[model samples]
Target: MAEQKEDTQRERFKAFSHVFDEGTLRAIHKESSIGSFEALQSPIKIGKEANVFTAVKGDELRCVKVYRIAANFKKMYEYMASDPRYTGLKRNKMSIIYTWAIKEYRNLLRAREAGVKVPKPIHVFKNVLVMEFIGNKEPAPQLNNSSPSNPEKFCETLISNVRTLYQKAKLVHADLSAFNILNHNERPVIIDLSHAVDLRYPNANQMLERDIRIMCEYFKKMGVKKDYKEEVERIIAK
Candidate 1:
């Protein structure tokens, strides 16, 4: 039984190895050997730009997001160039994508420190990021896909998280929306922090307001009674 299990594990690892480039495979193997994860379980999401997978680490499960090297590098470059922190960055496509992954990891750490409900970042290498999984057996569904039973309370909680992220974390989630939020057991778990930026960024305030507006409009469409502009002002006031 032990030998059979070992063979099955080897076969699974071999299959996953084919999905990544040689360099990436080496990095993944290094991480696994160092105890980051035991094995790749399955893919959770395959977005146009990145692929998110679930991995096992001892008794725990984690999420691994891998950015595709052949993805839209031009768009990644454009986005990175706009961020004040990455200003004057080199024009290397792979470097830009790798930096983007690092940014997401750092942003999630900042958000977690601020008490915002987000996946805890585990490790990052090149264009791959590992984070705490949000669900038990399966990944959590996005808020857009799973509406909360209490829309009012849920919206309030989400707004509070946004405010905490901005005021305490000094970061703005430029792409905040229902699609990026995970409804984990009726609570909001924000994900996809790749576009989050520091408050010192030139357009940080504008981005914050836009995020608040998006959240308010989404809740309003779902029958929540609230003033979006007022909510934005209140959050910034703090």
Candidate 2:
């Protein structure tokens, strides 16, 4: 039965094999071999840098994110280079990509510890990460696709989450926006923490301002009245 299940999972993943180099494949297999997850079920989201898949883990589901080795490492390096945590990191492509995966795992851990609503990271192996799934039977829709029932209340929740992320976690989500937020049953759940940087990052304040502006602009369209500057002040207030 176990062998048959593995065969089925392999066939399912075969269609997306182009993104999985031999090294990444070995990393994924190691996760299963160690019982991190039972098997890959389906793709959650596929993109240029990373591919997220939903996998079975006991009675529940887990998300597996695989950072492609062929991704635009130059762009990743440029973004990662500014992060104080990765300062003086080797410019080697594989090392940068692997570090990107490790970075996200660490960021998620920090955010969770700070009481932020984010996917709970399970384990990170090389360029692959296993984390808690964020939805019910089907994945939640992105905030851009699913508007909230009460925009005012929802926006407040998100703002509070962002403030908590900054004040408690001391990290700025450099790439935050509606695109990376999941509207789960009218609540906001932030995702895509790979671009987040510690407060000590050179451009952390600018990134936090950008994050607030983008969120306020998006929420403004939904009838949530908020001044971006005021929100920024609110966030940065000691």
Candidate 3:
């Protein structure tokens, strides 16, 4: 039975073989062996560097994020280079990618510990990360795709979470946007912490402003209006 199951996973994995290298395959198998999740299911989203999938773990569900080893990680290295936590990072492709995933895992945990709303990280391997699936049967739609019924409330929640993330967590989600925020049952759940940085990063303030600007622009389109500068002040108020 186990051999048959392995064969089945191999076939299924081959469907997306373009992204899975031998290292990725080994990481996925390790996750399964350690009971990270029962099995990786269909791909949920295939992005520039990673692909997301829904997996089963006993009676519950999980999300598996696999970062492509062959991805164009130049931007990733550039982004991570300035972060103090990753100082002196080697330029090796796989090393940079793995460290990128590790940084995301650490950021997720830090944000969670600081009471910021984010996916609950379950496990992390070299380039794979497992986290709580944020949806009912199907994964929740991005905030952009599934417009919230109460734009005002949704905006407030986003702002509040941003406040928590900045003030309590001292991390700026450099890539914050509607695309990375999920409107899960009308509440916002932040995702994609790979680009988040600590408060001490030199560009943290600029990144924060950019994040607020994006949110403000999105909300403005939704018939909500707010001064971006004032919102930033409010979020980082001491």
TM-score of each: 0.92, 0.94, 0.94
lDDT measured at residue 83 in model 2 versus the true structure, 0 to 100: 80
* TM-score pick, better of 1 and 2: 2
Local distance difference test, each candidate: 0.86, 0.90, 0.90
lDDT of 3 by residue, 1-238 (tens): 9899878767766776666878898898889888888788778998878899999888898999999887888988998888889998999998899999989999999999989889999889899999999999899999989999999999999999999999888899999999999999999999999999999999899899999999999999989999999999999898
Cα error, candidate 3, residue 74 (Å): 2.1
Find the number of clashing residue pairs for candidate 2.
0
Cα lDDT for residue 105, model 2?
96
* lDDT (Cα, tens digit) per residue for candidate 2, span 1-238: 9899778767766766776877888898889878889788889888888889999887999999999888898988998888878888899999999899999999999999999999999999999999999899688889999999999999999989999999999999889999899998889999999999999999899999999999999988988889999998999998
What tens-digit string does per-residue lDDT give for candidate 1 at 32-139? 656778788898987788888999987889998888877787877887787788897788887888888899999999999999999999999888788999985878
Q: Give the TM-score of candidate 2.
A: 0.94
Candidate numbers sorted by lDDT from highest down: 3, 2, 1
**What C-alpha lDDT, on a 0 to 100 scale, does residue 108 get in candidate 2?**
95
